[model samples]
Target: MIRIACLIVMMMAGMLRAEVDARPDARVAARDAAQRLDAAARQMDKATTAKDRVKALSETVHAYEDGLDAMRDGLRRATVQEQRISRELKAREIEISRLLGVLQSIGAAPAPATLLHPDGPVGTARAGMVLADIMPGVNSEAASLRAQFEEVTTLRLLQKSATETLQKGLVGAQEARTALSQAVADRTDLPRRFTADPVRTAILIASTETLEGFASGLSQITDAEGGAPLPDISHRQGTLPLPVQGQVLRRAGEADAAGIQRPGIVMATRPQALVTTPTAATIRYRGPLLDYGNVMILEPQTGLLLVLAGLDVVYGHAGEVLPAGAPVGLMAGDPALSGEILQETPAGMGIGSGNRRSETLYIEIRQDNTPVDPELWFETDKDD
Candidate 1:
């Protein structure tokens, strides 16, 4: 019994003395994102061609987005973990105190006294066996408590240092956006399907009152239909990627704040988020349209039009044919300068419920000038 008690004491002491140097999984993820951002930045600096620079800058923007997301998620998880550990520790205070007292008493007693009980040798032998059986359980509990304490300390440290990481990620994202804009301006290798007839486009714009009318008259704005045949994407009908990284904010035919229903889906995205072409297609029209803000209309297939609106800066001309994953435009809003935006939660909510995504992108798919569900064509599943 004395030996068993000594074993438990040693196990607890060893656990308490052990330091937890390993970071939490969340913190590790954040660091990995940071490394990706650094790599993308270096790639941009070493790029030898305009194409390479644009690709590098796009990667840099994506890396920063991923990094900032990691930081927010890590901060939230740390806060929850710390709170849970604190609650468990506080709730088990009485039990822990009793266990500690019993251990102290056992250590204080002499070996001879412990071995010889008032009920004689048989009683002492039974006590020894019982102690031996319960030793493992006691050791397990001690180990758990020690781990919780270490985790609490680590979580607190992570929360305290998150600000610096978040700030750096924001700054890196802003720089990448600026560089990408310049690279896109200097790019001139993209193929053109046909030269746009500006006179007809201006006339059409002045006469049209609806998106349907504008789309129906798109052929009039193009000088000719002759160009290299676009690759057949009939087999990839349901597998195309979304133009931007975001979460579905509203589905097709969903009403807005003013109860006005639209035949398109809305996506919640991060500020200055890059919007790309899901497939190689001709730029039908790109500029300010009625009330949809700056829009980019893509003709991936004959009679099929994909409309993307709510962008701040639109790229490409009306006739330029862009390749898949090409930069089309960026979402509105400046990059956050601090971590305070990440920590801002809704009323009566905790830190984990907060988000920095403040921009929305509107998407629509039209077939033969008729609006269809955008989700039917674009993959809407996002990790966020």
Candidate 2:
């Protein structure tokens, strides 16, 4: 009976030792899983390309989930072990109480020799020894369980870190997508057609006025004498002058089917192109007139009316004399006929008017309030 009791005690002690030794392995496995998960999350953060980032994030999420599941499974197993150990400890405790009760009834001390009592056969003796051995085993198992719990908690913290990192990567990817989409939209181009006929007409009309003569004429008009001296008309006799040159999409007379009457001239250039003018002869005016969207009239001298229209910016003052080729302002196509001009010469001259494709310049030469065809005054074959 004593031998059997010794064998049972040895077996219980072995079970307790095995449980305690296994705890370190569980902790090591949990730590390894956390390391893998953290590494995957970091890789996801470094990915820059769209496809690569997507792949990396997917891998990272999978790793985190897998690690979390592994940790949960380990915790579950540990909990089951804990419960089993607790139940075994309780059963042993109840058996010990029964033994104590038997000793009390017999009026004897609860001692190891109680196993030798008449009712205590070999089985009872072995059971008493097993209970005693299991007590130390239960204590060791409790300590190991506490360590495993701590390891599981650490794993949870690592999982949270990985989850946050993954979320940040997703946000960054979304922002990049938005930025790229906007960039493409902003760079898109619009359809535009260049009408060479209008451009040629604008250039031709701009070349008819001489900058030197205009400047000289303006100076004479602003003099204090009320009537200024005229320049030597002989010097300007044969030279082809630069007329209204900036940008003339429409002429100064007549209207087509669109009810859009032509303006004197239109200009669309930068401020640098404007001519220098004397302050005394600068004139400023603004109002709706004919085909001109906004008109500015600057009469530098008597009998000379300088009209500026379709302007986005005007710097001339009233009574100021601006030189020729000065930048007046910008002109857009008319809203009525989309800024288009008809090109056709009048019928009485030798040149057939119908042969001309389009007449963009609507020029009229006026001498002392009487209007005349500009073609008769201007040399037609001059360089455009």
Highest lDDT: which candidate?
1
What is candidate 1's lDDT per residue for 247-279, written digit by digit as tens? 899888889999988899899887788999999
Best by TM-score: 1
User: What lDDT does the true structure give each of the candidates?
Assistant: 0.75, 0.38
- On the 0 to 100 scale, the lDDT of residue 41 in model 1 is 58
Q: Score every model by TM-score.
A: 0.81, 0.25
Q: What CA RMSD would candidate 1 show?
A: 5.4
Worst 10 residues of 2 by lDDT: 347-356
Model 1 off-target regions past 4 Å? 1-24, 48-51, 109-122, 160-163, 195-203, 224-226, 229-232, 337-355, 382-384
Q: What is the lDDT of residue 305 in candidate 1?
A: 89
Report backbone clashes per prediction.
0, 32
- The local distance difference test score of model 1 is 0.75
| Model 1 Cα shift for residue 382 (angstroms) | 11
